[model samples]
Target: MSEQRLIELEIKIAYQEDLLQELNKIIAQQQHQILLLEKTCQLLHERMNSFRLENNDEGNEQPPHY
Candidate 1:
């Protein structure tokens, strides 16, 4: 290949490497966010279940004003 063609190919390879690194970073960040959201969902589910259990325990009681 000509010198100029070889230089062009090198430049293209460099750009592709940079783009690949950036994409990898974005994917890593997304994975971290997904994990955090999953944890939050689990916590909320636990809280909801606890609340339901508490309400069930009191479900048979009458109001003070009744």
Candidate 2:
């Protein structure tokens, strides 16, 4: 293979490697964000359930404007 062609291939490989690393970093960040959102959703769900239970305990009080 010609030296110039080989050098071109190496340059392309380097660029591809750099792009892959950048993509990996972005994916890791997105995964972390997804995990955080999942946790927040779980917490909100639990809080809502607790609120429902509390309301049930009160046994449907009449509206304050009643």
TM-score of each: 0.89, 0.89
Model 2, span 1-66: residue lDDT tens: 999999999999999999999999999999999999999999999999999999897878877788
Candidate 2 differs from the real structure by a C-alpha RMSD in angstroms, to one decimal, of 3.3
Give per-residue CA lDDT, model 1, range 1-66, as digits (tens): 999999999999999999999999999999999999999999999999999999998997898899
lDDT of each: 0.98, 0.97
Off by over 4 Å in 1: 62-66
Q: How displaced is residue 11 in candidate 1, in Å?
A: 0.3
Please give the lDDT score for candidate 1.
0.98
Considering summed lDDT, which 10 consecutive residues are worst modelled in model 2? Answer: 57-66
